[model samples]
Target: MAEKPTLRWGILATGMISSWFVADLSLDRQDAQANHVIQAIGSSSLEKGKAFVAEHLPGKSPTVYGSYEELYADPEVDIIYIGTPHSFHKQNCLDAIRHGKNVLCEKAFALTAPEACEVLDAAREKGVFIMEAMWTRFFPIVRALQQKLHEEKAIGAVHRAFCDFSFDMKIPSLGPASRLKNPALGAGTLLDIGIYSLTWTILGLEPPLGPAPARAAPEKTPKVVAAQSLDDGVDVATTIVLLYEDGRQGIATAHATVKSQRDFARIEGSEGTVIVEGDAAAVPSSFIVKKLDGEEKRYDFPRPGRGFYWEADAVALDIAAGRKENAIMPWAETLRVMEIMDETRRQGGARFPVDKD
Candidate 1:
């Protein structure tokens, strides 16, 4: 039997995303290739940290630190999971890396591409693993789709791709200082939900060029011609056209304050179309291939743990193998996606304070 390993994770925030990530840790069958244990909770308030454990991480007594710095200093923590708001990602990641801890940061990797590049460089200098938690890319269903569309050529000669990720977030009534509405906190549909639509674009439309981390900066970045409608200094809805160097085009849409039920990401080519369907378009549970000859095939991948554990497990496995970055969603991929979104926001007049920096 292969030696099963366990990785200790320190959570940086007590937010909803943090809860989801830790909850999935339990769903993982412990026997295995890798396992995750909650080592610590680093929140602004120790009381809040303890409260989070009482609720989200019940029965698992993790060290509750009143500050993130304390959590970073923990000798037992193998990796840090940064679930702080989008605005704090760069700083959170850098802090964790400076402490020599590996990291899994929840996406939008950073408020800007430069920020992403800076943090990636820091992690590289520190020689620790770092990955943007584009959790969907780790899903078996998405992996199967990628293999079919790219390797098997299930969709031949792809020409166009379309994706939409939106929901009724009710941002208008929320406090201006709230993370969801505050530009200071990197709030916007583009940086938050729009990433999902753009991720599908990169995964489905871009040439299956195989994820090769540039180590330096990426050579080619996609061109984003886009527009958006902002509400109270934040993008509420946006539309984008991604033009790839190889002449592939993707049409994507994102909405933060609108109600959308029929959300899907699909790619079309000469051979057929691959359609991804789920309540949330980002982490889909199933996919289908529709051929022009009227042949339709469907695939279903049951997500026993709400689809978050795969990425966490992947992080543990990669670390065990001594890899610094994940091939599926490499640092270059995160940087490229950030650049596109940054430019898209610039075109749409939804610039944040971070943009001026």
Candidate 2:
């Protein structure tokens, strides 16, 4: 067996998401593909970064950089896992790429499709690997579901998919300039949680066919129709419908202010419908397959960590093989998803300030 090449990761921000991801690496669990290391922590202050490292990357000491520039300049870092705010992704990835670090950026790769393109184009030109960290795409259950629905034809011609990712994040109390409601910060339910709904839709309707850069083959962007309820200029509730050329459709709903029942997603097909149950859409635990002929089966995937490690391993796998992108979540696919969100925001009239500028 070829020795797995370790990918040294430089975490871009010290946030809850970043903590979850870093802690996943240190968890001694079933997954032994321990091929990635947290080399550095970057934050607005060295003290904050050091605190984060001590809290999450426990038992191991890594260099803490006061600024992202310091982390980017470090030769020990091989790749960057960007857990910064949505508005910061483009600039962060650009900086990381300029320093020749591969990137696995947080979802909603940018505030808009154009920004995502800007980052992707730079990565392509620099010959460095980069991908949107849509970690759900790398989850064990999702992987098994993809093979079953697409390859095995278990569902037999999927017609539509429906997913909802909502939480009582209390947007009303978060203040206008707070990260949840601030337009300049790329704040909205669509980008925050709707992205996951839309992700599941794409997974069901348009499973990517391996990593394809630009100039490979162009397909029409998904037709998006959406509606949003605004809360002080931010989307508090949003529903988006994604339509494929083949008439397949998906409805993804998200809400930010009010509490809603945590729902399981369903994909309807000719033969059966697959339902995924999750506390949050991003972390699904099990799925039930119910066939039209009255047969049913349940597939459960208990996560070992916060379920971020799989994608981290995937990043290492791609970089080790000298690949520029991940087949599971390709660059073109990220742009397409971002474009879909842009369209949804446009149609829903939920424009961020960044969009106006």
Candidate 3:
């Protein structure tokens, strides 16, 4: 049997998302195709870094750094996982790329498409692998559903998709400087949660999805129209409609005032419709397909440790193969989605400090 590839990870933040990613990496899954080693941790201070290790990664002795610079300079680290807020993603990715380290940055990839372009350009110049950590796209259940819809044509000729990623965030109660309400932190329903709704829209509408057709970037960009309700300059609710070149349409809505139902997304086609169910859009676990003939089928996936390990494993495999980007979640795709958000925010009247000219 061939030996499994191992990727050494340098964690760049000591937050909840980072903890979940590291914990998933630490799980001993017999079916995992690659090995993920938490090589180091970089936090704002030594105390916080040490506390993160003790609590989330107990019994593992990864070198901890008090500063990001120290972590970036470490020679033993193979890749840096940027779990910081969206506002910091561009700089974090640039710093890691400057150090010639691979990166898996959390989404929304940046405050806008232009910012995402800079990061991707830097990685391309540096010849290091980098991918936006849209982990939900790598879920086994999502993959199976896509295969059924797009490959098998289970839902023949998709016409429209509706997706919602709403939850009661109680935005009014948060302080002005809170991450949920602060524009400086890239706070907005469109960027924070609406991106998932857009993801579902794209997944349901785009066909033959394997790195969109060559030189079709212009044709692939959807026509976007949107509206947003703001709370002290932060978007509290948003609705975006994407019109495709082929006449298909997708409706994506997000808000902070109500919890979304378990079946948060529906893709309707000529022959049938697919209903997606999950705790949230970010952790989709199952789907049901209902045909016009009254036949129905359901698919369920067992999620372990937030299901982040799938993307981590893909990163390891990509790096092992000397690739600078992933086919599943490539740079172009990241930019494509970021462009959708950019247009959505533009039409919706949501602007951040970084977006200022």
Candidate 4:
């Protein structure tokens, strides 16, 4: 048997996601085959970084840095995991790449496709690994669904797909004052939570065509129908129609106000329909599929922790194997999502000050 390669990881940003990731990594220590280790954590303040290391990481005593630059420069760190806010992803990733470190940046990779492209180009030139932390794509259930869709033909030629994710922020007003309401931070339901729904659409929809276009092949192009925004600069709500040349359509919606009982994706075809309950980006405990023959099937997947450990494991394996990115969350897919998001913001009139100039 091949021995697992040990990978030393540097964590950038000490936010909620970073905390969760640290806890998950620590738990991975129990597995003898797991090859990842958190070597250091960098926060805006030394106090915060030290506190995080104390509280979550305990006696491991990983180095703590007051700034990301210090973390990137740490020779012991093999890769950098970015957990900064959406607005800072591009710059954070570029810095890590410049320092010759591999990166696994959190979702909403960047506010714009152009920014995402820049990061990807930098990673390519440096010959280092870089991937969007779209953890859901690495989930067991999601992988199972992808296989089922292809093998069973449960949803034939997916004619339409609908996905929605909504949560009540309970904000009193819509203004630039609140980060949730601020456009400058790239804050919005779409970027924060809607990206999950978008993942479902992207997964169900196959890649666009190029030289070869089969008769029943997935569409070569997609066009957005409309995008709506609330009074705030952020997109409190948005509905996007992804059109395929093959006459297939994927509909996605995201809203900040009001809660959704079930945030899932429904893919319909001529033969049957599959209902993915829970956020596809964040897999739930179970899912169900309904067939045209009046039959219903259910699938359940339960894992230890918040199910984020899988992505961490994937990152460790990839870095140890000297890979540039996760095949599931490729740089191209990240760019495509960012492009769609940029267009959605433009059509909805939710422009950030940075974008204005």
State which candidate has the highest TM-score.
3
Instruction: Score every model by TM-score.
Output: 0.95, 0.95, 0.97, 0.91
Error of 2 at 139 (Å): 0.4
The runs of at least 3 residues in candidate 4 whose Cα sits more than 4 Å from the true structure, single-residue gaps closed, are: 28-33, 173-178, 207-219, 279-281
Report the backbone clash tally of model 4.
0
lDDT of 2 by residue, 51-168 (tens): 9977777689988999999999999999989998899999999999999989989987999999988998999999999999899888989888888888887889999999989888
**Candidate 4 Cα lDDT to native:** 0.78
Q: Which residue pairs of candidate 1 clash?
A: none
Best to worst by lDDT, what's the order? 3, 1, 2, 4
Question: What lDDT is reached at residue 174 by model 4?
Answer: 51
Per-residue lDDT of model 3, residues 1-357, tens digit only: 878899999999898899999989999898898989999999999999999999999999999999999999999999999988889999999999999999999989999999999999999999999999999888888778888888899989899999999999888888887778899999989888999999998888875346433523423688898999987778999999999888899999999999899999999999999999999999998899999999999998977778999999989988998889887788888998898888878888889898854
The 10 consecutive residues of candidate 3 with the worst lDDT sum are 210-219
lDDT of 1 at 213: 50
Per-residue alpha-carbon lDDT of candidate 4 for residues 323-353, written as tens digits (9 for 90 to 100): 7876667666788788887787777777766
Model 2 regions lying over 4 Å from their true place: 211-219, 258-263
TM-score for candidate 3, please give it: 0.97
Query: Who wins the lDDT comparison?
Result: 3
